[model samples]
Target: MRLRNKPWAKELIDAHPELIQVQPEHVADQFAQKQPVRLEIGTGKGQFIFKMAQLHPEINFLALEMQHSALAVLLKAQVDAQLPNLQLVVANAENLQALFAGWHFSEIYLNFSDPWPKTRHEKRRLTYSSFLTQYQQLLVPDGVVQLKTDNRHFFEYSLISMNQFGMQFQQLSLDLHHDDTTWAAANVPTEYEDKFSAKGQPIYGVRAVFHQAKG
Candidate 1:
């Protein structure tokens, strides 16, 4: 789906450096404390990450989005809410290696990312091997990756991709909403997840950790 362009979006995001960084070279001081940082890539409208930050004030949340309009909406709310632990960034995931140089996160999230269903666009998937490598580099040893999506095919592909990358799944839920596990009890919904799940579509989720190698 083509996103509606907001001509004023860039200006709004640019005006607030503390709330959102438009050109983040490195993950420099987004928050005051050196708490455990969790990154959510493709933060659509910032629903999940924003709420996560609110729930876990001890942990810092960084939301990275490629869209100005969607991010601007979140920035507006962030400005008013003023959650010190929550920060936003406008950057592509492909640049994460450089952006997170010398910085590592305890956890990473992929919330309702674009499926890029076509086989030719396989590399564009967030769970692709290249992106997985980037995540591994930016994540601390034994760091966790949590993902939620409504697309089954994409979810299957992601499982295969991550498995091929030697990442092991700590938790897997076919119907997250219906799952009665403790992990599912902590499930948060993105905008897309809320919308689709309301229509009786089951949400899929996975918690994975990169395989640790012995020295």
Candidate 2:
């Protein structure tokens, strides 16, 4: 996860100011009337988020990553793309609640997130119930969380955790390659996704919708 030595990291740090920062209180009001905000928790190298920003100019995007170097790459990409609606946050995913207040984001993206395959590390998985609660706090009513991964075990574990949290799976695909219809529209292949898919890996993914509880 440490990318300090990467050449691209230094370049990103030098050009960081172009990226916007969203404090916890301002997140909701910033996108109140304009367009729904979409967040990507772990934007590796910036390929996916940049594409999303390019495709949807109206929607605001927040790319969060813990590694300073990786964040720099994303920031540089945003700068290069001249994307006005994109923001970058350098923080751990665990502190997402502390970074944004109230219901703000309409959609959340988790592309090729760390599997944390070991049993002891299950809690660290981004789709775990504990993380889902944090996401729920920031997500708007009926907000959706979209996730994709090549690890079947992690996908199954996520499905279980999502169900336990009472989130509904609006779309689910076991073998992304075999399902061309959905894949055609849904596939915006991230850097990791492209790498894995080219190697003939079977990608699995699910888009879960969060329905607010009635009082």
Scored by TM-score, the top model is 1
RMSD to the hidden true structure, all candidates? 1.3, 2.7
Which residue runs of candidate 2 sit more than 4 Å off their true CA positions? 1-4, 7-11, 20-33
Stretches > 4 Å off in candidate 1? none
| Model 1, span 1-215: residue lDDT tens | 44598888888877888778866654457686888889999997888888898899999899998888888888888989999899888888876898877778999999888999999999899999999999999999999999999999999999999999999999999999999999888877888988999999999999999999899
- 23-125 per-residue lDDT for model 2 (tens digits): 4344433332467789998887878888888888889888888777677777766667667677777667777787775547899999999999999998899
TM-score of each candidate structure, all chains considered together: 0.96, 0.88
Clashes of 2: 0
For candidate 1, the 10 contiguous residues with the lowest summed lDDT are 22-31
Q: What local distance difference test score does each model get? A: 0.88, 0.79
